[model samples]
Target: MMATTHALAGVALAVLVGVLFPESAAGTSLLPVAAAALGGLFPDFDLYAGHRRTLHFPVYFSVAAAVAVAVAVAVPTVTTVAAALFLVAAGLHSAMDALGGGLELKPWLGTSDRAVYSHYHRRWIRPRRWIRYDGAPEDLLAAGAFALPALYVLDGTARTVVLGALGISAGYVLLRKPMVEVTQAVVDALPDEHLDRLPARFVEDFR
Candidate 1:
């Protein structure tokens, strides 16, 4: 999925998990909660690169956790679990992004990139390495953006789960069509010379 969608999902998931298992949630400290949210954005650091977004390997997650723990020790505000969850959320979001397809997730072992979020590998190590950034499907992005907040509100109950599901459905139905219509309008509004520059995918995919 796109970084935005993954970030939205990660935030909502953390909130939902925090709410559902309030007592057992890893992040007891507010610092950790914030850290987790930040950590969730960790994998996407690749956006700084010239290429698209992709998942870092397990090593990246481990390094992130260790760095977070060390930082927590100095800060003395967050706990081990809190920092760990931050890394885990980032890793999870990276993993889920693969489900959207158009790319493969491979483990980036060795000192390939950097320390924490160095590099990524393909789901398969083929004769020819083919790894690309996998953005979220348009409908999935729209559905996820809405569903995540709904899930957070639902907070993991059966009723809330139902509501979240409905919200996802509604988003898929509404956003996709409206986005297309809006794109058409924009295209029509733009000068003929600028038509080539305005890709419809931008309107549909970019929320």
Candidate 2:
């Protein structure tokens, strides 16, 4: 899924948490929403290094999130609620990767088997391809689906953020395939030395 999609999913989860626990700090402040959105984007930060393998701990994050949720429920401070939402969002992002296309230059081609890394299992999980690929039309739909409740419930800055994400998601869906082509063109024109420094996926298929 697109980063926006993941962020929206996190926001949706936070909103759900707020609805379920109206008296909690999560319902009163945007901190937990922000935390969850950031957490959703956190795992993708490893995109340059190991991609899915570096920080996408599907099992471990889920376990930690479970514990964190328990702690938050027991005390329900702003800090605990934010922390719990963060872990839960991160875990959700990691696990949700399995439902998308694989990690490759052209994931829509269905060529790669690896969707996300599972350190606990010491292997890669295969892509389910339910959404085909990030930035696909279906991905935009998924983003919209997650954004609905958030847009309905949130106001001020949070609502603006969701709108911005929706716009970005729409633009990305249009450019996703073209961006890959442009990257390939740029990579093809680069010198061998520079190409060597680029990520393997960028050069491997072009070479």
Candidate 3:
């Protein structure tokens, strides 16, 4: 998986849940969906500071939920519902990371100097799994970061949206990764001195 994948997966799941569950839908408001999309990847802010663990934890999530609830109460419509929707999206993101077969997110904030890694998300028929990092489990929720917006206009049944979005996103990711891989391959062909100047996250040194 990749960052783009995680985001799309999360959006696909949230919209599907909201539309089908109706119970999750915050009425006509798109606020919750927006919040959820934002919250879904809120955890990834951690990557920027290299200390963004809190953006992903239950405690932080609780705070976000409170804010969402407050907005729901204040606006009391699709706006308020947006808050609830956000909670669902963020919650889903966290839960997925927790149960992943190959990945173990920084479960609790302030517990590690570095994020832990495993294959926890790779399980079969897993339950309530979070769609953490779409790119790789070690990463944050990057895929869903993009997927959420694309799915916003997704029309039709929940199942249909998921199927459609999944197909589109998976293809997008596969296409992107190989280009990166090829670019990296070219970089790998370069002499060590030439590669030394490239940034780590840059495609030139995509290891």
TM-score of each: 0.44, 0.98, 0.50
Residues 20-84 of candidate 3 have per-residue lDDT tens digits of 54644443444455565566666565554432234455444556667876775566566557666
Stretches of model 1 off by over 4 angstroms after superposition? 24-30, 50-55, 62-77, 103-207
Range of the 10 consecutive residues with the lowest summed lDDT in candidate 2? 198-207
lDDT of 1 by residue, 85-140 (tens): 67766776555544333321222222123222225453322211122222224534
Q: Per-residue lDDT tens digits of candidate 2, residues 121-141?
A: 999999999999999999999
**Candidate 2 — which residues are off by over 4 angstroms?**
none
Q: How does each model score on lDDT?
A: 0.48, 0.93, 0.48
Count of backbone collisions within predicted model 3:
38
How many clashes in each structure? 7, 0, 38
Clashes of 1: 7
Query: After TM-score superposition, what is the CA distance of residue 149 in candidate 1 from its true location, in Å?
Result: 5.5
User: lDDT: which candidate is best?
Assistant: 2
What shift in Å separates residue 203 of candidate 3 from its native position after superposition? 10
Query: What TM-score does prediction 2 earn?
Result: 0.98
